[model samples]
Target: MTDCLFCRIVAGELPATVVLDTEHLFAFRDISPQAPTHVIIVPKAHYANAVELAQAAPALTGELIAAAGDVAKQDGIDSYRLVFNTGADAGQTVFHAHLHVIGGKPLGPSGLDLH
Candidate 1:
């Protein structure tokens, strides 16, 4: 896990524009912004992906979702999109479990064509 990018971010070894930091979660702006307001919310604890995190810590998974909602409200965005790419084939460039909160604009349909 030492080489995990998200783990490094959580440990303060990597620099990230932090938006929210709770005892169990850390939310930061994505380095590569796909939308006007894009944030990546990750658990302080490392998990390979959504399935892994949900299986091991269901409560934490729920907290993550709630945190995303809180972030949307804080950003004053009533409509937003939450995306979780589970595997490499699904465009998960990072292995760590995280949620991408995208808003601040009228988004188009999310499809493979976009990628």
Candidate 2:
């Protein structure tokens, strides 16, 4: 986990535009944001993905999700997307467990894409 980028971010070893932070979770803007307000929520403790998180820390998992909701409301997004890419097949570039809170404007042809 030493090489995990999110872990570094959580540890303050890397820099990110942090929006929120709790005892166990951290939320920051994604460098390659999919939406106008794309934030990534991550746990301070490292885990590979949702499956791992569900097993290792179920209570914190709920807390992280609740935190995401708080962030969404604060960001002025009435309807947003919470995405958890499970693995490489699901477009998960970062190995650590995280949730993407995407909203604000449309993208792609239909104005619904995040790219």
Which lDDT tens digits does candidate 1 get at residues 6-112?
A: 99999999999999999999999988787777899999999999999999999999999999999999899989999888988888877999999999998878642
lDDT of 1 at 102: 91
Q: Give the TM-score of candidate 2.
A: 0.89
Q: Each candidate's lDDT (Cα)?
A: 0.89, 0.85
Clash count, predicted structure 2? 1
Candidate 1, 76: how far from true, in Å?
1.0
Candidate 2 residue spans exceeding 4 A from truth: 106-115
In candidate 1, which residue pairs get closer than 3 Å at backbone N, Cα or C atoms, i.e. clash?
Answer: none
Steric clashes per prediction: 0, 1
Q: Summing lDDT over every window of 10 consecutive residues in candidate 2, give the lowest-scoring window.
A: 106-115
Residue 69, model 2: Cα distance from true site in angstroms: 0.8
